[model samples]
Target: MSATLNPNIFRAYDIRGVAERDLTTESVVPIANSFAAMLVDAGSRDVALGRDVRASSPRIAEVFRQALSSAGLQVYDLGIVSTPMLYYGVSRFQRGGGVMITASHNPSPDNGLKLLINDVAISGDRIQEIYQGAQAGRKIVADGGAVHTTDILDTYVTELTEQACIGPRALKIAVDGGNGMSGPSITRLLDRLGIEHIDLYCDPDGDFPNHHPDPTQIDTLVDLQRTVLEHGCDLGLAFDGDGDRIGVVDEEGRVIHGDRLVIIYAREILKEVPGARIVGEVKCSDTLFSMIEKWGGDPIMSRVGHSFIKATLRENGALLAGEMSGHMFFKHRYYGFDDAVYAAMRLLEIASNVPEDAPFSTLLADVPDTVTTPEIRVDCPDISKFGVVDSVVSHFRALRPVEDIDGARIRFENGWGLVRASNTQPVLVLRFEATTDAELNAYQSEIMEVVTAAISACDDSV
Candidate 1:
């Protein structure tokens, strides 16, 4: 067998940890071998291997390629591409699997692998299976296992631009790539579409020295916001580490969150595909679902996570889906995967219709203003986090009607709140929304009270 596998590294949707500590060359080898076996089981010997621009990524990717090759799989090396590009590379084949090496939004020292099997996102049991197989150290050699280095960036750009259905006018915008994987691809997209943009940290750097490559955290968008105001641009777009999540700033330098982004996309999409279903996670603003329904589209409320929302989209055949964490997925004339670069273009596509004289914030003028809290992450042990969530569910379920698809989404008379265990971390994520500050505070107080009690109880009892 291989070195004792770190169970913590095998997360829900990915394998993530501090690279040198948890994912040594010895560890990655068996993991890659296991993933190769997974591809083989899926009736495909071809595996797409891609990596981010992190300093440690190349070494990890090389280890993976070697292990995969040794395991008798044809490895398609799509070098130094974003996570979405890696997904796209795998999607090129009928039955394909791939691994993207990047700890999305995590710090520089952290690294991870997001896996897809037969182009379907792997999660839950599948990830655990990989971990189990890795422990087993299954390695089989077959003929014709080799590495095929490929270049699909131009083709990806060509296809994305070919499907362009934007307004006539082009506008100057600011783009903050966060020195991650979004630089080259977004620049190429902006160039092809004739969109003027001011670049902010558009070069890929593993250290992410400027700011953390997480667009969801408002702290990370300071540079992007400043750039937009200084440039007198119509808007700003920010991308996360692996270029799958997007953050936007309006002409007035207001941060437009993912929920607002979804509404904007939904409004435009409804014009073309009326009554198309859209999915958004519970952490999203209630306005997202209400507006989608009001705009003649079916809105499906999903649990918070990429894999869960993707499964919801497939189940409902939704044309679009989004998360509060800045992941926008569109099957409307494009692949249904979270791609910040594609979503940025789509945002521009919608904004292009707006008059040059008007500010971009006007697009959301109809979206009823509401008070919403950013995600509040409460520290809870992995063992007790879900239990605490369940206690919260029970407490709320006894008090009022609640939805617990992934957590307790309690809809109070004046507001709504969510309490759920994070899929990838040992924390209970909470968010609240209301029409007024008082209502928002009341909702938060009520939820936090129950959450605190439940967590205390979990700690003492179990």
Candidate 2:
């Protein structure tokens, strides 16, 4: 029963890797056993568990349940639910902890676990500890912890509807679930809110037959844009594989970036709660931070990742926090966890109040324009990405002022360039923003030179 676990799968945010290679049923049992032991050691008697519709999910969930029960921890299995719902269930039921069997936008061939301890998303050193325990072949053998099957979809939909503010505008929306986990929850929530919507790829198919579930990639949103335009809908919304992140399109079939979405959401929320603190990831546009301040609310920059941002939100008592990758967390009227379906509903509520003559783009007309790069993901070996980041950080620190908040964000006079290791993928994430095209190019060139040099040095050393 002692399978060698891949330490790389124990990522900064969650556990993820190729299902066939890193997440075999045998390997998953040890992980689950370690998780259950962690909960039991912390005095948690019960756990709320859920999974996505991936092919490996059922087997993984069953093995996990067995492990939990074996560790003397009751398991409330919410079969085939989204990541957000898993978080909601744990927080709602006041359970000791929860585990979501999902990879959240990773490809169909991949699967992973999103862990929660005491209602907080677990990450960093805690995740490392789990890996260490599993490697040590640690097992907690106990007796008499029962497993119960439960459905929280209806309850989740009802709760979100109660807290949502649906505008009186009878708007038409087109939603593409990308054969991920968003369809059922979003459709139900929209139905309860009395809004008209068209569903595309709403059925949860683990194969992801229509397209990859990651809407942040422009190509993935093509079908959604076509659907919105063809249906003449007022908006189009797309969700990742686990429904925790969202990608949106305006009425004119234009994909809206996360920073722009923040502007719209913050404008509405600030009107109601003036001076409320709002947070955006370090990768977000500078305009977003400045605009939040202009709107009379404090803007706090945070490290990317839902777990990190959620912790920051609570620490600052911020009502809202978002990332450029589409993870939007709202604490205004809902839980602090990132929930895309709820965010889409909130977007609709905001759009309904806009004048008929204006478009969603108009809502952000006042924001200053700047040249920025779409998240540039440079592929690196999982073993080397972190080293690459560290090397780059060291190289840049001697040249310009660098902010190592999450990564090295080298600030220049006109703009800033970021180089960081992606927590979820084996890639070095890079982004740059500048006041003009020339300044943007200069900043990008300077950072690219350092990154290339560091990567080469890393490879040479290896």
Q: What is the C-alpha RMSD of each candidate to the true structure, in Å?
A: 1.2, 1.5
lDDT of 1 by residue, 76-188 (tens): 89999999898888775643788899998999999999998877789989999999888887766677779999888998888889877678767999999999998899999
The C-alpha lDDT values of all candidates are 0.88, 0.89
Instruction: Put down candidate 2 lDDT per residue, 1-462, tens digits, no spaces.
Output: 557788878988899999988999889878888888889888999999999999999989998889998998889999999999998999888989999998888889999999988789899999998888787777798888989999999999998888877665678889999899988999998889888898899999999999999989999998889988898888899999999989999888898899889889999999999999999998988889889999999999999988899999999999999999899999998888999998998898888877776766677677788899888889887778788888888888998898899889888997899998888777899999999999999989988988888888888888
The backbone clash count of each candidate, in order, is: 0, 0
Candidate 2 ranges with C-alpha deviation above 4 Å: none
Task: Count backbone overlaps in model 2.
Answer: 0
